[model samples]
Target: MRVLGVDPGLTRCGVGVIESGRAREIACLGVGVVRTPSTDELADRLMAVAEGVEGWMDAHRPEVVAVERVFSQQNVRTVMGTAQVSGIVALAAARRDLPVAFHTPSAVKAAISGSGRADKRQVTTMITKILGLESPPKPADAADALALAVCHLWRAPMSDRIAEAEAKAAQLARNHRARLADAARERGSTGGQQR
Candidate 1:
């Protein structure tokens, strides 16, 4: 599976593309940061971000997009910008009909490292080892994006299975309800004939 991981920030959104093999090996296809100047107007910045993300999607053609779920921070403005950037990333994926998955920071850390509370350095180090990179991806944001992709790669199989099971259960329930309705209709018709 090919995944594009997005660590969305207004000033520097990170984008990473990775391919997961059947043997559970992860290969980093690409990694980069999309920078928008703080001096730019909010609308321009957003547009730049949208274009940057869309360009990545077009270039990599990833099957899935994994985005970092925005968490509330003390800085409301920062959180809001992050949320907006994340939305743009998701929208870009949605435009291509790609599946999008949101992974929490803690979840990414836990999946890449052993602990949910692992620090940035630890996560980066582990990511480097996992991908057999000579060095950690420059900028913590880029590494985070890679981690988000890896997390989704690891989790998607089980997640897909669970979704399939739920769908099957729902279908069975619907069929059962249809049968019950049919039986009720037959009983009602017979009762009406006796009137």
Candidate 2:
């Protein structure tokens, strides 16, 4: 599966594409950051981000998109910008009918590293090692996007299985209800004929 991970921010939103093979091997197809000028109008800045995200989506044609969940920061403005960028990311993917997943920072850290409390350095180091890159991806945002992609790839199989199981259970319930209804109809028909 190919996944596009987005680490959204107003100034520098990071985007990464990663493909995972059935054998669990992973490859980094691309990684980059989209920068919007702080001086630009809010609407223009958001448009730039939307265009950037759309370009990645077109280039990668990812099977799924993963975005970092926005967390409350001390700076309300910063959080608001991040949330706005995140919404743009999701909207871009939604336009193409691609599935989107949101992962918390801690969840991403735990998926890449061993601990949820891992620092940025540790997360970057683990991502570099996992991708077999000689150096870590620059600008923590890029690394974070890569981590989100990897995390989704790693968890997607289990998620798929769970979804399949739920679907199957729903089908069985539907079938059972149909059988019961059919039986009731048959019995009613036979009783009316006798009457």
Candidate 3:
């Protein structure tokens, strides 16, 4: 399955594409960052981000999109920008009817480096080894995006199973409730006929 990971930022939103294969083989299709001029108007900047994300979607045609969840930060402005870009990425995926999964930064780090507190360099190093790249992807954002992609690829199977199990459990509960309701109604009707 092909997956696209997005690390959204107003200045430099990161994008990465990866394909998962047999026996968990992973391939990096692409990794890059979308740069928008800070000096530009917010609307224009958002449009730029939207266009950039849309272009990646069209080019990669990923089956699902993995996005970094925006967490609370000391800088409110930074968080706002990240959230805005994140919305744009989600919108793009929604337009394509592709599933969008938001993963926490720590989850991505742990998935790639086996540590939730792994630094950017550590995550990048792990990504390099995982994809067998000669050199690390430039800019932390790019590596982060790749990490998100890898995290999704690794987690998706288990997530699907969990979802299926939950659905089945819900269906069983509904069926059980329906049967109980039918039994109660039958008892009530027989009691009324006896009156």
Candidate 4:
């Protein structure tokens, strides 16, 4: 499948496009950041990001768009800005009706490095190795975006299976609990005792 991955930010959003399946391969369709001048108003910056993403979508026509999910941290302002950027990324995908998926940082790390706690450098190293590139993609952010796409390629199916399994297990647990409660009530009524 052809997938476009986006690492969204107001000042510099990273983008990467890759095609995979049938064979494990990738073409560096494009990689770069969307930059808006610092002097520009925040609203303008956001608009630029959205426009940039739209342009990429038009050019690449990816079947799916994978984006990193915004993580809330101690810095509320940063979190808010990241959330806005993520929203734009989602909107861009929605505009095209392309399938969109989100990957958490931990999921990306685990997919790339077999460990959720892997550091950025480790993730970068794995990406480079997987792509068989002599050097890492530029601007770190661009590399990260590529990594996110790769992570989704590897993890999306597994995640779906896990979610399905969990849902089934939860339903079973609920049914078992209800049966136990029903049995208890029946026993209480038959005994007709206040014990």
RMSD of each: 3.3, 3.2, 2.6, 4.4
Ranking by TM-score: 3, 1, 2, 4
Q: What TM-score against the true fold does each predicted structure earn?
A: 0.85, 0.84, 0.87, 0.79
Winner by lDDT: 3
lDDT (10s digit) by residue, model 4, range 24-110: 676567777887777898898899889988898999899899998888863787678778999988987987899899988888889
Ordered from best to worst lDDT, the candidate numbers read: 3, 1, 2, 4
Model 2 earns a TM-score of 0.84
Provide the global lDDT of candidate 1 against the true structure.
0.93
Q: Report the number of backbone clashes for model 1.
A: 0
> Can you write out model 3's per-residue Cα lDDT over 1-195, one digit (the tens) per residue?
999999999999999999988896899999999999999999999999999989999998999999999987749999999998999899889989999999999999989888999998999999999988889998989999999999999888889899999999999999999999999999999999999
* Candidate 2 residue lDDT tens string, 106-142: 8999999979999999989998998877779989999
After superposing all C-alphas onto the true structure, candidate 4 shows an RMSD in angstroms of 4.4
Which residue runs of candidate 3 sit more than 4 Å off their true CA positions?
A: 170-195
Which pairs of residues collide in candidate 2?
none
- State model 2's lDDT: 0.92
Worst 10 contiguous positions by lDDT, candidate 2:
19-28
> Candidate 4: deviation at residue 29, Å?
2.1
In angstroms, give how far residue 89 of model 3 lies from its true place.
Answer: 0.9
Give me the runs in candidate 1 sitting further than 4 Å from their true place: 165-195
